[model samples]
Target chain A: MCKKPLIDLHDDKLFITFEGELTLYTIANIEKALAYVKTYSFNALQLDFQDVTFLDTAGALFIYNLEKYFTKKEIAVTLLLEDTTQKDTLNLIKENMKSSHKSVPRKQKSFLEQTGELFYNYYIGLLSFLHFFGKLFTTNLRYITSLKNIRFKEIAFEINESAIRALGIIALTSFLIGLVVAYQSAYQLKIYGANIFIVDMLGISIFRELAPLITAIVIAGRSGSAYAAQIGAMKITQELDAMKTMGFEPFAFLVLPRIIALVITMPILIFVADMMAMLGGLIVANIDLNITMELFMDRFSEVIAAKHFYVGIVKGPFFAFLIAAIGIYRGLKVKDDTQSIGFNTTKSVVESIFAVIVCDAVFSIAFTNLGI
Target chain B: MEFIKVRDVRTVLGDKIVHDGLNLTINEGEIYGLLGPSGCGKTTLLREMVLLQEFTSGSIELLGKRLETISERDAQSLRHQWGVLFQFGALFSSLTLKENVALPLIEYTELSEKMIDEIVRFKINLVGLKTEDANLYPSEISGGMRKKAGLARALAMDPKLLFLDEPTSGLDPISAREFDSLILKLRDMLGLTIVMVSHDLQSIYDTLDKVAIIDNKKIIYEGTLQEVTNVKNDFIESFFGKMK
Candidate 1:
């Protein structure tokens, strides 16, 4: 039940009467009515608002923009206001419109500029990670000297979360890997009447490389991302700041417990994974190579050296340290946004898994060079 | 002119009965305040009004459409008719203030980018935020600025009805008063029917034209502050007693 503005053109002058609420909802209809006025030749435009019931910011802005449009065409304009309140609104909107004209839109970056920014961000990230690592190292050293400074309860909770809960998935994945490796080797060994060689292949690969690598990768995805997300969320909600205010170093309180728990549980988890893998290989050998379980165990103990087990288990702590450190480092790097938590969690997983594989490669080269 | 009418709304959140037989009417062009004690489901009622929460029974007629049975298309169109400002300024953390304000316009309308930019600048200025603040993310700004940015985004579509949840809670006295005045000015200029949930007494007294005090799972009083002050209720007595 709103009346459209009446437009009448007489000689060189134009008269317009506005009625009802001249707000955002009605402004569109007013625009359609005025669309015909642009075709007429008028030197002076008179906007009569004596009967207008209401005028909002958008309405005021529309009138202001209409005046500007006519004035740019060298046509003069006059506004007849019925109320002081409407006049005040129009003036308020007019003032804001003038100030808003100064705001520049964000500029687009060129390809080179974007590339340069990417490189610069990576450099800064590297430096920050190094600083975080140094702080973590020194905090661990200082806290390790004092037994009471460590939070044993929190460490236990973390172990339950990262290690104990992860057993089922790790067991399944390691068993499957062991079965596939033994089956593949047995196929080729049986061709040469060397089906017993499957034991040597399964033992060396599953114990020295596959078990440790798979376990680290799984833990990296599971516990590493959890660490980053937990710490990052805490940072976002300012809980880290709260801890700092209460004289608790976040490194000692949040990061150390996670790192210690992961380190202690990692070797133990890897050892279980190694045993499960050997059992899987034993089954495969018994099934495909006609070797009995007792016979396979006898050959396995004779051939599989203790050094292979040591090499795989030794890398467990290093992989754990890398995953936990990267996770915490990424978590601390989270800025004041929820999206940063997601981004950092993803980065934590990717970086930790990458670091684990690279460290494994280095270990392989070193052990090979030393004739281990 | 009746923008919203809640009739016998019964809300049960889990086993806890949040509201029973709640009824209120919000007329057009009035700053209506929903005042209550803590844990009285004031925010819950606001959420229910905005369609973020559901009621067990009865009807909430917003803009003449019953909320419980409103179709998806009707709900979508009705949503475009009102703007909601959450308590914590619920701004997108990733986007800058300008982009945050422009999101609704970009998603709903076919306006040109240049036009959207102009409208964004106007809204940012209208809310008393500096032009330079447009480039900064929500996390970079203070609580007051974030609320202002949120208000700006809420107003971007130039909606007829506005809903504000505790708009002055986290602000300093000066900023809070400024916010109250801004609310008054926006209502006057835009002809907006505002439904605000507020615990701030000063804000309620300064800005509200009418108020509905909810206590004990139902509205204890619904009228002007002067009339509400005369009501014989423990909550009303303690709430307004602080005015002394």
Candidate 2:
């Protein structure tokens, strides 16, 4: 069929003369003709069905769709059915509309019914997870392709400000944490005349858990919150939309850079946190036990194996992913309301921290079993 | 000739049908206004036409290609043909007006910095903003100036099709009128096909070649301004009445 033509009505009313059978075969012809006539301004569509030799349910369904389309636009469609074949089709449409109008008032449910409905919805939601998963999988390639344009400078700024900016505070906290762990362990060791092994205790704790967990927590609050707030505010004000409207994918332009930045920088920060905690432990070992800095270092290297270092570093990127995922998810989920930006930012940080803790525990436990 | 054709688009956000089989045909180089009250889904429909929205069912064709079926790379490249000015004058707060206007050229093309700067300056001048105004960020500029800056950015791409959402909103009467004149001048100079979502009747009448009014989740009126002006319906009359 030819592309639809613009139909202009010259008067308040016009005649639509249909000169063919209203059968299944002729439905396509009728629709083609109607498409051309529907493009322009019109008041009413007059259907001339006198020449129609036959009409079936398919033809009836086509007309029903047309009537619904026109009616919603406030344009009336009048059926001029003169043939017996057309009469049955028109009658069927009228009856369908009447029955739909009478369908039990779309009954409001009782509490029990509502509960049942909620359960049913939840079941359907479980089934619909595949749909969500499929969309994400299909869109993953596009997301990856956007990585090409991510300026390294943009990523560096995001990472440096987000993860590195909190370094001083993290170091301070790690120092206190190290001192406390060392002192507590020394007290317990003193009870058994094994106070000298405090070096092993502080070193193991810092490398294995304290440093990684503390650094992850710091990032979840600082970098993750910033990412969410920035993106969320951009979304609320339509800067993200502006990018899309200008032919730049918002995911590529705004999101990918931050993801790259966090991924690159998180491990580096964890390394810093580990060093600070070790230094704090060294201080405790020297002052409390009268051990030299050199001696403490020698024992720390001996007790904390390469596995601990690898484990901590591995968790950094995973934690980064958790932060980026939560941050971007919360940002993308923000509503148009300006207040939601701050709210979502807070939500992202909390969710990131929670997710990090859970994932870290799972990873540590699984690795402990594997003895990695 | 119809440059953009929407064929029976039916869109729903979950349960609510925002566009119930909405259809529109916009011709080239004409200013078409999608006029409606808030919540009538004019923006949703425009977004659908531009392929920014996914419809539950129906088809959209722009410049002879089926919108839904087009390759994303093609979509991105073809999108250069249209420029959208979002409702809030969505400028990057981090960037100055010149940088904002130059963004598209920088993103879409391999233009050198100097050439991009000259184009950005030309666009800023076209929107009636001074050269000095180009250095100011969106937060530093007046709301009216921001809107003009948005228009300048939209024009920077030199798009054949331009989409605008509430261009006259939040502007003083003079600024609104000035915007209307600038739109007319742009259309005259570039022969741009403009589609805008607006509730402002005065702006609609001043710049539109045709106005499509959305009501009850459908297009209630589509015609010349004079035809809409002559409409006697209470809502239609009151809309024009307020402008008068």
Please give fnat for model 1. Answer: 0.00
How far is B138's C-alpha from truth in model 1 (Å)? 26
Against the true structure, what is model 1's DockQ? Answer: 0.01
Cα lDDT of model 2 overall?
0.80
Number of the top-ranking candidate, with DockQ as the measure: 2
How close is candidate 2 at the interface, in terms of C-alpha RMSD after superposing the true interface residues? 1.2
lDDT per residue for candidate 1 within B1-244, as digits (tens), equals: 8889999999998699989999999999999999989999998898888776789999999999999998856776877778888777767675799988897787678999999999999999999999999999988999999999989988988999898999999999999999999999999999999999998889999999999999999999998888887888999999998785
In model 2, the runs with Cα more than 4 Å from the true position are A1-148, B229-232, B241-244
Clashes in model 1: which pairs? Answer: none
Per-model fnat list: 0.00, 0.81
DockQ of 2: 0.50
Off by over 4 Å in 1: A1-41, A46-56, A79-88, A99-101, A107-113, A182-195, A284-291, B1-244
Q: Please give the RMSD to the true structure for each candidate, in Å.
A: 23.1, 19.1
